[model samples]
Target: MRIGLYPGTFDPVTLGHLDIIHRATVLVDRLVIGVAINRDKGPLFSLEERVTMIETECARISEETACEIVVHPFENLLIDCARDVGAGMIIRGLRAVADFEYEFQMVGMNRRLDASIETVFLMAEAQHQAIASKLVKEIARLGGNVAKFVTPEVRKALQARFGADC
Candidate 1:
C-alpha cells in the first residue's frame, strides 16, 4: 500500500490543514498526520490536545475515504518518523513563495536522509492561504473571532485556552 506522511506542529489544526488533509487522502492509500512535539515552537496546545483536535476534525475524512487517516505525535527527525511509519511519501502544504523556500531546503535534506521517500506539495486553497495556526491563535488570544480559520472543536479549545470567546 502507498502510505504518505504529513508532519506539522498543528498546534490547533487550521482549516488550511483540513483542506490539505482532504486533498492528500486522494493521493495515497494511507495518510498519517504526524503531529510534531516541538517544544522550541512554544505551541499553544499540548501534543495530546493537538492530536485530539486533529482526530476529532479528521473523523469524517477517515470514514469517507479508502485512505486511513492517523494522527500520531513524534519528536525525532521528520524523516525518521516517516521512515518509522513506513511512509513512502511526505505531503506538504505550500501557501506561498516563502513557504516553498523553507520546504524546498527541508525536502533536500530529507532526500539525503532517505532518497526513496518522495515529497508532494499541495497548494492551499486561496481562502485558506492566509490563515496560519500561529496567526489564528494570536487573533483568538486577543479576543478576535477565529471561527473561520479553524474547526469548531479547535475554536472551542482555543476559547477555553485563552479564556475568551472567539
Candidate 2:
C-alpha cells in the first residue's frame, strides 16, 4: 500500500492541519500523522495530548476518505520515522514562501539521508494559510477568539490550558 508520513509537533491540531490531512488522504492508502516529540520547542501540549487531538480530528477524515489514518509519536529523526512507518513519501503543508525556505533545506537533508523517500508539499488553503499553532496559542492566551483557526474541541482545550475564555 502507498503509505505517506506527515510529521509535525501538533501542540494543538489546527484547522490548517486538518486541511492538509484531509487532502493527503487522496495520495496515500495509509496516512501516518507523525507527532514529533521535540522538547526544544517546548510545546504547549504533551505528546499524548497531541496524538489524541490528531486521532480525534482525523477519525472523520479517515472514515470519509476510506484511508487508514494513524497517529504515531516519534522523538527520533523525521526520515527515520518515515522508514519506521513504511512511508514512501513524506507529506508537508506549506503556508508561505518563508515555510518553503525551511522545507527546501529539510528536503535536501532528508534526500541525502534516504533518497528513496520523496517529499510532497501541499499549499494550505488561502483561508488557512495564515493560521499557525503558535499564533493560535498566543491569540488564545491573550483572550482573543481562535474559533477561526481551530475546531471547537481544540478551542476548548486551548481555553482550558490558558484558563481564558478565548
lDDT of 1 by residue, 89-156 (tens): 99999998999999999999999999999999999999999989989988998999998998888899
TM-score of each: 0.98, 0.99
- Ten-residue region with minimum lDDT total, candidate 2: 46-55
TM-score of 1: 0.98
| Residue 1 accuracy (lDDT) in model 2 | 98
How far is 63's C-alpha from truth in model 2 (Å)?
A: 0.7
Weakest lDDT window of 10 consecutive positions for candidate 1: 58-67
lDDT of each: 0.93, 0.96
